[model samples]
Target chain A: MTKKRLTPPLTDADIENLEIGDQVLITGTIYTARDAAHKRLVELLDEGKELPVDLKGQIIYYVGPTPAKPGQVIGSAGPTTSYRMDPYAPKLLAIGLKAMIGKGSRSQEVKDAMKKYKGCYLAAVGGAAALIAKSIKKAEVIAYPELGPEAIRKLEVEDFPAIVVNDCKGGDLYEEGVKKYQK
Target chain B: MREISVEKITRTVRDLCIEAACDLPQDVENLLRQAKEREESQFGRYSLEKIIENVELARQDTVPMCQDTGLAVIFVEIGQDVYIAGGNLVDAINEGVRQGYTDGYLRKSVVEDPVFNRKNTGDNTPAVIHTEIVPGDKLKIMVLPKGAGSENMGALKMLKPADGLKGVKEFVLKTVAEAGGNPCPPIVVGVGIGGTMEKATLLAKKALARKAGEHHPDPKYKELELELLEKINKLGIGPQGFGGRVTALAVHIESYPTHIATLPVAVNLNCHAARHKEAIL
Candidate 1:
């Protein structure tokens, strides 16, 4: 019932207080990576090698954007399905990745990871590529350019819209929202 | 026999690929409107509205409706009397996919192999093509840009004849309920009943290509579709599975005659952004 727009991401307490289905407009630095990049990062971790980017207090967007057209810094950037990244999320969270942005429900393992690591999961509007892209003030490829669209990129966003799907307090919006609406 | 130029098929197929990728089909647009009106939750209604807006932005601005541009799915109905002059029909379709994905600036998602190496193909070639020979001079082509999310959730089951319609419906509703928000709610449910295992799956996928809200020709199946839609919406999965009364925009069932003791069912889901385009040549 309560709604708030976060132009800049709030504290973990702010995220935990959000009810299921509460709309939020988030502004902050979010990193982009897809299946390929996640796999590589996890592998690097397994080898005890340093990662290309720092995970502390960072948000990882599950996206692979199209080539930027003309003058745009990024192309139709939107969230991919979250489940594909379920396997690696716990490890990333353990490493200090605080927030994950994607669409759809995360598995219990990911939710458990969020609770254990004091991390969160945010759901961006799925399929709203152009609208979502407008939020990005800056975007540049940071690593794995060989993966092209699937590469990891750094994006600075302002008022990027999202909803908290899972929070560190063991709350899950997708589950609660469904139960509330069950007819 | 009628001779058809390979060049024409190649070009037309490419057009279909791009069209299906960039634009949301009109029938689907209307169905989403209806679902929005019927949805009970404010969040579900809002989500549906966002989807409608996304389609317009994608169409007017020439951007992809979804980031997953999807795997190329080609459905070809070749006339028995027609002869393709220059090359193989399948090859022509694949070439069209390559050109369309590259030209449209869509994502190349397919891997060169499934098991190991799993290297990206760069250009999305080798479309999943289903070809059928029918009585006609013209070839009909339908392109469905099927995203991996819903496609990954697709399932096929073989049941004893005793299970019947109720069993089929339960399985479908369970799939949607279990999927929750994963496939992206306000989804279109495509059900294929009968046929062999893989054939049933193919038929289910093809069923999703139909215009949203349209029902099966058979009265019994149409009734089943309506019932399934009601049950799915009642699950309260809502838009993006955040709870709502309009979890499914529509349910479409396609069935075939089956063996005496066997019944088979396949469910293929298409998210709100169901992208499909067709052409005849």
Candidate 2:
């Protein structure tokens, strides 16, 4: 598999050629949200109320990270399971939300949205939070402070590593990879 | 009777919580190494390497091993002759939980209400404590910080005696297969067979606290563990569900004598970072 470097505010061209199993190192700004934050974001959309941040062509990382100790930029930060966000992903992707970094599989609706919206799903190593935190250079809670760690935070990252799990072309590494190795 | 101070239990619980949260258990770590050596898929192998590296970073830096530090599940085995002095036992444990989550900077994932309010408790408190009275005067405390990732995927089933061993096996395999990558592969499958519904689930969870890679004392359950482990790895879920030959590191089954007609089975899964730390006072 080919390795590629990416920056956020991604365009269709930035992800169209990416296939499942391709390794990527993302550098730039990405937003953080978990199941709780996604619910609020979607609620705002349904009410026609503007969201706190523009999601267009941006990436969302599913994480709620441990509290950072003194002198640390962030604490252990890794991807949470992605399926819980499936109910809300199609709506976000419809609004130009680009890639998502998380672990586990997504629902069929999410896969369809990725295909239609020119977005892809990336999988970071689950439980590799401390290692993942090393790539995050800065973090701030831009919205929903009441949600505690579930609050929406903007993070600046450098070479944040992940692998393409689902792609715009409907390729799924989970399905293909399992079939290849199943005895 | 030996009198043990509440202060000592609190201090011990606090330290155990931090230790379990940050350090991947040594036995589980060794199993991952073996899994890595045998992995045929390049992606699976690469994923394993990163996990190994992350475990080291967290331990060396005294940081949480994962972002979801998880809820503290404490198992306390107190000797029948030991008298807990100075304070109520439950209160002392919660106090310890508050301190450990705070001092360790572990994430507070617990909610004040499961259905409503949904507010963070600020400090992780009221750990799920399971206490048993044992035969000796010593008190043993074990903390397993269980993450929601794997815990959410657990399942329980009640089968007729007719279903027997075959049905139980089918249900377990199905649970793990459907769980797939969600629980995080290279998982430990903890099975509880027999007992009532709640009892079975408790047994399943407690089974996870058992040291990884050790078989049940009974020969029948021990054989079942080995067979299930082989079947699970063959499913090709692999490391991170990327597909490989090492989907599960161990399968531990804890069983109890059952009623004549009912066989209840429960499954609890722990991610590759299967962590548990204990202290005996």
Native contact fraction per model: 0.73, 0.84
Location of the lowest summed lDDT over 10 successive residues in candidate 2 chain B = B117-126
**Tens digits of lDDT, candidate 2, A79-182:** 99999999999999999999999999999999999999999999999999999999999999999988888999999999999999999999999999999988
lDDT of 1 at B243: 86
Q: Could you tell me how far off, in angstroms, the CA of residue A105 lies in candidate 1 after the best superposition? A: 1.7
Residues A55-170, model 1: lDDT tens digits: 77778899988767677778888888999999999999888787888988888999898888778888887877767888898998889988888888989998887887887878
Candidate number of the best TM-score:
2
**Clash list (residue pairs), candidate 2:** none
User: Model 1: residues >4 Å from true position, as ranges?
Assistant: A1-19
State the lDDT of candidate 1 residue by residue for B1-281, as single tens digits: 89998888889888887788778888988888888888777777777888888888888988888878889998999999999999989888888888888888888888889898678899887799999999989899999988887888888889889998778988898788887787877899998999788878887998998988899999988899998888888898888887888888889888888899889999999988888899988
Lowest summed lDDT across 10 adjacent residues in model 1 chain A is found at: A1-10
Q: After superposition, how far is residue A137 of candidate 2 from its true place, in Å?
A: 0.7
lDDT of 1: 0.84
